[model samples]
Target: MRDYLIKATAFDGQIRAYAVQSTFLVEEARRRHDTWATASAALGRTMTIATMMGAMLKGDDKLTVKLEGGGPTGPIVADAGANGQVRGYITHPQVDFDLNDKGKLDVARAVGTTGSLSVVKDLGLKEHFTGQVPIVSGEVSEDFTYYFATSEQVPSAVGAGVLVNPDHTILAAGGFILQLMPGATEEIIELLEKSLEKIPPISSLIQQGKTPEDILNLLLGAENLKILETMPVEFSCSCSLDRIKDAIRGLGNEEIEQMIKEDNGADATCHFCNEHYHLTAAELDQLRQNGELQ
Candidate 1:
């Protein structure tokens, strides 16, 4: 099935929940970055959580998630917007390691345990909102849980998982976020905690053909959840040749001339999607005339 996320409320809105199946979306990212198994899990989990967090925003509002774990996988950065657009990259996509003791990808080893998880949100205000917390666990989900509790001051449970095939492809990817709203009753919290402890890994559920709604039912109970909206999600990048050209122009005329004389042409590559753009000598000359090749 096509990837999508569900927003819902349970127990009369005292509990806010989100669940998403992001297999296709994460697969696209892995294909673009050529990430190894461990790196794929780390990056995929970050993307899954970021996409759900983006859903919390309104039009034109967006957020960037940075995971600087100081591990072999290096730093991971992801951007998500309310429009369901998300793009991300790992500083070291080729990193990999043997499965952990639990017979799962060693994400913590690849993601490292030292550093911080920071988020910057553009809420359409003069100043963006920023929050950060120490990385309590290199496992992406627990780190995000710590982030919400410490940074946002909201009690939350975050779970994300990605399973990779032997051929370095994505087998499954997805996650769930549960937040306790104001005045959440103790009984509801206890019920949720119990449910969380018993459910299978999110990735496994997605692999078994579970939809976002099905995930919510597994977590919050089918009868208790009130489905609100379903939004399509995917891997999307905003970078383009035009944007790259604009950036190149900002370098000034002398730099453009240097590229033309020394290199004959210019090549630019995007970090998010790894897309390469070539600027021919003729195009550079036109840009110089238009005062955009600087």
Candidate 2:
């Protein structure tokens, strides 16, 4: 099935929930970065959660999630737009290790048990919103769960999983986020805690052909779920040749001339999608002239 996200409310709006199928996007990331199994799991899980978090915004709002665990996988950065578009990259993509005792990818080892997860949200305002919290677990999902509760002051359950194949491709990737609204009753909270314990790993469900809607229904009873919106999600990057040119222009005429003289051109690469942009000597000259005009 095509990658998508489902937004819903349960228990009469006391619970806000989101679920996403992110296999295609995760695979795209793995292909671009050539990440190994453990690194792929770390990157995939972060991107999966970022996609759902993006759905929480409106209009032209955007957010960036930075996870630095000081592990072999290094730092991970994910950018998401309100329109269900997300792109991410890992500082080190070639890190892998044997499966953990749970028979799962050793994400915690790859991500480390220290460091922090910071989120910066641009709400189209003068100042951006930022929140951060120490990593409680190197596992992406638990770290995010802690981030929401400690940084945002919202009680939440976050679950994201990526199953990597022996060939280093993504087998499955998916996730869910459930938050309790104000005035949530203790009875409902207890019920949710119990349900969370029994729910299967999100990636396993996706591999079994479960839709985002079906995942939510299984987490929060179908009878209590009220579907809000469905949005398509994908791996998208905002970098382009024009933007690269603009950045080079901002460096001023002296820098532009130096690039043309020393290197014969300028090369730019986007970390998010691994897209490369080359500016010919002629193009660099034009940008210098454009800078003079401005």
Give the per-residue lDDT of model 1 (tens digit) for 205-247: 9999999999999998899999999999999999988897888
In order of appearance, the predictions have TM-scores of: 0.98, 0.97
What's the TM for model 2? Answer: 0.97
The collision pairs in model 1 are 252-294, 253-294
Error in Å for residue 144 of model 2: 0.7
Candidate 2 CA-lDDT value: 0.93
After the best TM-score superposition of candidate 2, give how far the Cα of residue 214 lies from its true spot, in angstroms. 1.1
What tens digits encode model 2's per-residue C-alpha lDDT throughout 205-224?
A: 99999999999889888999
Number of backbone clashes in candidate 2: 0
lDDT of each: 0.93, 0.93
TM-score of candidate 1 to 2 decimals: 0.98
